[model samples]
Each structure stands twice: as structure tokens, then as C-alpha cells.
Target: MEQTETPPPGRRVALAVLGLSAMTIMANATVASSLPGLKRHFADVAGIDTLAGLIVTLPSLAVVITAGLMGWLADRMDRQKLLAFVALCYGLGGTSGLWAESLNAILAGRLLLGVGVAGTMTLGMTWSADLWQGAARARFLGLQGAAISVAGIVFMLTGGALAGLHWRGAFAVYALILPVAVLALLALAPYSRERRRAAPVAKGMARQAGFPWAAFAFVGSLGFVFQAAFYITPTRLPFRLEELGVANPLAVGALMAALVAVSAPVSLAYGRIRRHVSAMSVFGLSFALIGAGFVAHALAQDWHGVLAGSVIAGLGMGLSMPNYTTWFLARVPMAMRGRASGLLTTAFFLGQFASPLVSAPLVAHLGLAGAFGAVGGTLIGLGLLLAVAQIWWPEQARPETAPAAVS
Candidate 1:
């Protein structure tokens, strides 16, 4: 593996790139918050509730279908350029709802937004892995998680606020991606071209590196579980809050923000945590926190208890995401980084897409509180099982060390 002699971009530039990456997650956050507004606007449409719900979830479906193709493209093309193009599409497709005359048209726009998000997110992680390594890589991955958490808070609040005016106002947030596309062009374009020219490894070398099937399966599995659990907050928490007699939308937004707020600081400290604990231990702890948070949510009789539960759950949410990314990056060859990242993205969003399906039945059968209890108990059991596995088969829990040169 030949290292580039050219200095990496400044921290500001790196942050700018990562900031754009954050926008990918915000696609669903704001739109999910605006679902009620959309539902009302399209109330005359048959299956209007389901149709409006798809506006929030359809992008995940797109990502699952297209992320692999986007990842393949990233490996062969100029990633920075691809990022800019996708960002432009993200803005256009995301805001398409504002002008769309019909529910079907809005759904079409969401599908397009999904395409843009797939490319942007897969490429963003691939680019980050390319630019950083070792402890810095861990820290940057943490920052990526932190950035997404912060963006979720901001976007969710903005969506809730805008939903008060009109669902169209919520779509306005998508236009912010246009400026991010410009930033990608200005800050990353030259560097990407430089790296391509300076690279010494042959294309055949990358091809011969071979995919890490076991590692991919392991990470993808974990990604699915983590995402499904984390999504319970966004998909179900608001309604739970409403059931508990906290019906103000802003208060619901505030509580949701609390769930993610702790994630930012916790994610920022992931490097430090990684230094002391094994990856398996980190996963176990993250699951434990999530389980504990959900149990609190199950038991809570008031809003303050919900806030406490969110804070604890947020800690788990923060740790689980970065830990998975760090674990994946550590094992995969650089040549396969994009493809592997795409698979991970697919697994994650597939979980996001499935969360409601898996949990909805439970909600109906058990009621919201019982549903929380069931999920909490399951997560705690998983945490305990993983912890025991770590003790019994520590070697298996650790990431595999890849060859020095991917070729």
C-alpha cells in the first residue's frame, strides 16, 4: 500500500466534506417529521397515510437497491465529482415535493432523492476511509456519527417547525444540499484528481484483492440489528410521547432531539473509549445502554422519565454506529472499501425500512409501553449474549487484520 506524500486537506476541508455526508441522513429525518402535514394535504387520496409515510421511508428503499451500484461507481470514477452530481440531484429531488401537484409526483421525487442519497452516503464513507487511517480514522468515523446525530436534531426540529406552516416548508430544507454540492466541487475535486494520478497500484491489483465475505456478513448483520433498534426512537417515540399526554409537537421534537443530543458528545469520545475496551465490549455496552433506555421508556409515567430514557438510549445510539463503521473499515481492503460500504449502507437502511414492519405488530399486540419493554428485553438479552461470546471466543469477536497491501 503506497501512501500519498501530499498532505491531507485541512481539518476545515475535511469537516466540510463530512458535513455534506451528514445531509444524507437528514433526508429522512425532516421528511419523517412532516408526515402529518403531508397526510393532511393528501387526505383525499386513497391510502393517504401509507402514501405520506412512504415519502419518509422511500429513500431507504432506493438506497438498498442502488447503493451497490453507486459503490461500484465510486471505485472506478472520480468520487468528488460523483458526490457533487448526486448532491445536486439530492437538492432537486428532495425539494420536488414543494412543486409536485399530486401525491404520486411527490412519491416520485422521494424515489429520486433516494438515488442521490445512496451515492452521496456510500461515497462519503469510502472517501473518509481513503483519507484517514488508524486512530485518526476512528476519530473521524466518530465525528461522522456525531455530525449525523447533530444534523438529525437540527433537521428534525426544522421540519417540525416548518410543518406548522405547510408540508412544503419542510421540503425547503432539501435545497441546503445545493450549497454542499458546491462545497464538494471546490474543496474535494482537485484532491480526488491528484490522488488518482499519484496512485501506483494497478487496477488489476485492486480486483485481485478479493472480497472479505465473512467480514462483510458480520458487519452487515450487526448493522441491521443496530439500525432497527435505533430507528425505534424516530419511528415510534413521538407517538409514545403523545400517549403519555405530552402532545405538543415542539415538546415531542425536543424529546426526540434529546435522544440524539447525547449521541454527539458520546460519539466524539469514541476514540478514547476504543483505546480501553475491546470492540465486542463496546458493542455489548452500547446494546446494554439501549436496552436500559427502552426499559426506562417502558416504565416512564411522565415526560421527564422519557427524557431520561432518551439520554441513555442516545449514548448507545452514538456508540453503536461508530463502532460498526470502525469495525468494518478496520477489516476491509482499501480496494473493496466502496463495495463494502455500499453493502453496509444497504443493510442499515434495510433495517430502517424494516423497523416499522417488525415493531408495528408488537405495538399493536403489546401496546406502546409493552412494545418498548419487549424491545428492551430483547436488546439486553443480545447484549448479554454478545458479552458471553466475547468471553468464550474473544478471538472471533475481534476484527481480522487484513494483508498489508490489498493487492
Candidate 2:
């Protein structure tokens, strides 16, 4: 058979993928925002309280298991076809949350949702890398990060709006978007079922082994702060406000939404930013803001303090988040992008997975103020650690030489 010339993903294809991922971000926001509402439906089910939160978390757990496989498959198969098929899980999983009366069904749906997230999240970067190399690819990937952050803001607010109507209404929106994703993907974009690459040889594996792994760990640690702050904050914020005599859940949601809204533009700014600053500087600044903000929140004992922390953290994440994936890829061979995506995403979500485990213990021992300070302290410590590495380890701080694309 004759081989066809590699066709790049046009802006339309990128937009469609962004649409699919925006829903994933929304699904994430829904579970975070709507957990209290889910309890009522779970009342008759056994183990409700302990289990309901897992529904929100199981997707990240799934990311750890599946992200690498999905990333590898993206590099080895027809990525667009894989994208369209996996997107169904995202829609279906959200729909289950809207409809499921029993706890078991919801858990099952959450697992499926994780599968969808793994596919989209990994492909978003690797697919872009496949389409464009160097600076252009970097900008496009930054745009994708911006899209997800904006969706975080949109879905957070949307979930809050629907909370008054009923929590199920928030998830029901996923059903509407899924079909639109299907149409946009199938009709507007062109991807064949076959991929164009020879298999990875032993030398390919050796090149992959030499990748910059520390950046993966450092950036992944920061991801925990991103998803955790948004996910857990929304869950607890209303109660925190209510305890302090604030009655409006909508207002609390709005506050979370506003902070989350900052992430997108900040993410977009990375494209311009990578031109001037080193990725290490971006990481240091973002985490420093986040860590300092948390300390500020601990000190304020008021909502203004909380908002200040959120704003600072949001600005920091926007700068740092997009660059990590690009920076991670920059240090690796192209053929390994899938494996790299998977490994990097796993680190990212694993941080998400650790959020409650780490935060809940602190809150139990120290109270919310202590908990914020504790989390903030950890962030600050990590920031300092990264700064040290950048200062001492010039390789991570400087631009990378192009390694061979995995053949």
C-alpha cells in the first residue's frame, strides 16, 4: 500500500479536541461541586458517606492505571479515531452521575470517566506535538491548557448554578455536550484508522530511558495543588462559609469560579512567557505565589484572605501548568511522547489522588487554618526545593538540545 503524506491537525481539529476535554474538566468540576447533592440519592445505598467522595476521586485513580496505555496507543494508532471513541465514556460517565440512584452504578461511571480523561489528557499534548514541532507545538499545547483551565471556571460556576435546581442538572449538561463532540470530531476532522510509524526498537527504548524525570515529579507535585484546590475547595467552601455565618452557597461557588477563571488566561500567557523566562522560573513563581497565598489564607481568618490566596495561587498555576508538559516533552524523544505523556499525566493525577489523603489528615489534626497552612507550607517547601534544583542544576533551567524523534 502507498503511504499518504502526514496531514496536520488544523485549528478545527484542535477546537474539537478542546471541546471534548472541556467536558472532561466540567465532569471534574461537577463531582467536586455536586458531592453534597449526591448524598441524598445515595442515602439508601450502603456505605454512602465514605463512598460518595470516591466517586469524585476514582477517575484520577484510573488516570494512573490507564494514561500511559492511552498515550502509547495515541502514538501507535489512529489518534483521532481513538479520541472519538473514548469520548463516549466521558459523556456516559457524567450521565450516570446524573441518573444513578445506587452507589455502585456511580462508582462504575466514575471509572469510565477516568478512562476518557486518560485518553484525552494524554493525547492533548502528544497529538499537538505530532501536528507541530518546536515553538508552534508549544503554543498550541499552551492553548489546550488554557482551554481546560477556563472550563474549570465555567463548570465550577455551572455546577453552582445547578445546585439550586438540583445537582443532577449539572451532570445532565455533559449529555448535551457529548453529541456535539461526536459531530465536531467525526465531521469536521480527518483522521485515518492507521498510524504512520515503525515500531520502537531497542535503541529507541534506550533514548527514552535518558529522559528528564525530575521535572516530571516536580511539575506533577504542582498539579496536585491545581486539581486539589479546585476540587476539594469547592466541596468544603460552602460549609466553611456557612460555619462563619455566610449563607450563600452560590456566592462561595462564584468565588471558586473566579479563581479558577484566572487559570485559563494565565495558561494562555505561557506561550508568550516561555519566550522570555525559563520553565524553571515559571515553576518557581507559580508555586511561590500558591504557597504564599495559602499562608495568607491561614492568616486572614476572613473571606478576603481566602480570595487573596486563591488569586495568587491561580495566577501561579496558570504560568506553571502549561509549560510542564512541553518541558517534559522537550527533554524526551518524540516516539516516546506517548509513554512520556502517560508517565507525566500519571504523576499529575497521582498528586490529585493524594490531595484528600494528605489534606483530610491535616484538617482532622489542626483545623482548617492549620490545614491551609500545612498545605501551603508543603507547597512552599516544594517550591524551594525546585528553586534549588534550578539554581544548582543548570540543565533543567536551560533550553534543551533536540534529541532524536523516536523511530
Best by TM-score: 1
Candidate 1 C-alpha RMSD relative to the actual structure: 2.8
Off by over 4 Å in 2: 1-9, 32-37, 98-101, 176-232, 235-244, 395-407
Using Cα atoms with residue i matched to residue i, what is each candidate's TM-score against the true structure?
0.92, 0.84
Cα lDDT of model 2 overall? 0.67
Indicate the residue-level lDDT of 270 in model 1. 86
Report the C-alpha lDDT of model 1 over 298-389, residue by residue, as the tens digit: 99999998999999999998888888777776666676777877888899989999999889999999999999999998999888988997
- Writing each residue's lDDT as its tens digit, candidate 2 over 132-246 gives 5555555766787788877777666666677658867776766755665665557444443323433345236646456556755656656656556534465555555565566
Ten residues in sequence with the least summed lDDT for candidate 1? 396-405
The whole-model lDDT of each prediction reads: 0.80, 0.67
lDDT of 1 at 210: 68
Model 1, TM vs. native = 0.92
